[model samples]
Target: MPRKVLVAYGTKNGSTAQIAQIVAEVLSKAGLTAEALPARSVTSVSSYDAVVVGSGLYAGRWHKDARRFVRRHRRSLAPRPIWLFSSGPLDASASERDIPPVPGVRRVMDNLEVTEHVTFGGCLEEGAEGRIARMIVRSGKGGDFRDFTAIEAWAAHIAEELAGPESR
Candidate 1:
């Protein structure tokens, strides 16, 4: 059977979900069978050979459901290849340092062998921001900063890593 992978995400306003979809698409194009779904919708990862989990970063934290999903399935996930990502930071100024999983999240990642943890720029649509965020955006700092080229590059790299020697 072909190796199967799951690309699951926890999102608010759907930016991370879009990123997850693209990641799954890239992986599928690279020769792996991949499925992208919401984190809450995935009941188990037992049948997947690998998993890619992502969440929208909010106030230096991952969405609760995404964190819980990993915590809930830690045992089932331990033996699989796992990769993590976050979509946040509305400015080009956001750096790799801004992307590490939050404290509670780090504890979960510490328990497993995570292949990679990436932080990608996110989008903030008009009227989607809270009061403070609106102020920030009004200050001219907010925009759809997601870099599709970088995103696709990262996904392609993941595809190569998970595709194995035969596919390579």
Candidate 2:
């Protein structure tokens, strides 16, 4: 049996939403029931055994709706294991220590006590699309830097951690 998992997300240009869907599917395939829903639509977290919250970044900060979602439900989430993910950071090749998410983002996780936080590169748009990603990562900086294999791999780890050895 799989535990109910809520994968909530907030996206601006739809890239992060796509990433959330991929993560939900990956977790589902790992024997965990996962559903991706927009942050504004998810009214309650009481039903889920675990949660994975992700938000797209804009202007070097998390999306506002995503911040609100965590603030609204942080009390409920503290008792349960929670994982936080941010779909930003155009650079993906940095060493673990060099990740800005450490000191820069510690305060964000402190309120919710997220058991883990993951950062993946943001998605880019081509010339005709004219998405924000291209503007931010100009000068040949950004692209669709999401690592599908890495995403699935982490989801599997989360599933195993939550389900326990006996269940797996």
Candidate 3:
């Protein structure tokens, strides 16, 4: 049977969710069974063979739902292969270079011994919630900086790792 992977994300403006969906699609295409769901919606992680958790960074912190999900599922997640991602750079920095996870995420990585973590560019369209988000959009600092190519490549790598050498 194919490995079941869950790509759970906490997103405020929906861009992170989109990134998670793309990652799930790539994993599925690579022969794993993958599903993307909101972190808050997931009641358990015990059923998945592997898990990919992602969150939209805000003020140097991950979304609240992502943080809560990790704290809630830490036990069930520790035994599984795990990957993590963050999206919240409103600039080209992520695409141009590697962006380290914020302190909070780093702590979680250490605790979970995550397989990998990545930072992708973020998007804040006009209708985004929050006064700051609207201000940024109106000030012309908001736009999609996500690199789909990089996102897909990372997901493919995860699939390859999960598939193992024997499968190759």
Model 1 TM-score, all chains together: 0.87
lDDT of 2 by residue, 92-160 (tens): 652132344544346767866677888877776565134555565576776777777777777877877
Candidates sorted on TM-score, descending? 3, 1, 2
lDDT of 3 by residue, 1-168 (tens): 338999999999999999999999999999899999999999999889899999999999999999999999999999888899999999999999999999999999999989889999999998999999999999999999999999999999999898885331
lDDT of 2 at 63: 76
Better TM-score candidate (1, 3): 3
Q: List where candidate 3 sits over 4 angstroms from the true fold.
A: 165-168
TM-score per candidate, in order? 0.87, 0.83, 0.96
* Cα-based lDDT at residue 88, candidate 1: 84
Please give, for residues 1-168, the per-residue lDDT of candidate 1 as tens digits: 237989989987788899999999988989889999999999999889889999988888888779888988999989888889888888874444455666766776788878878888988776764786677668877778787887888888988877666331
lDDT of 3: 0.95
The window of 10 residues in a row where model 2 has the poorest summed lDDT is 94-103
Off by over 4 Å in 1: 94-99, 129-139, 165-168
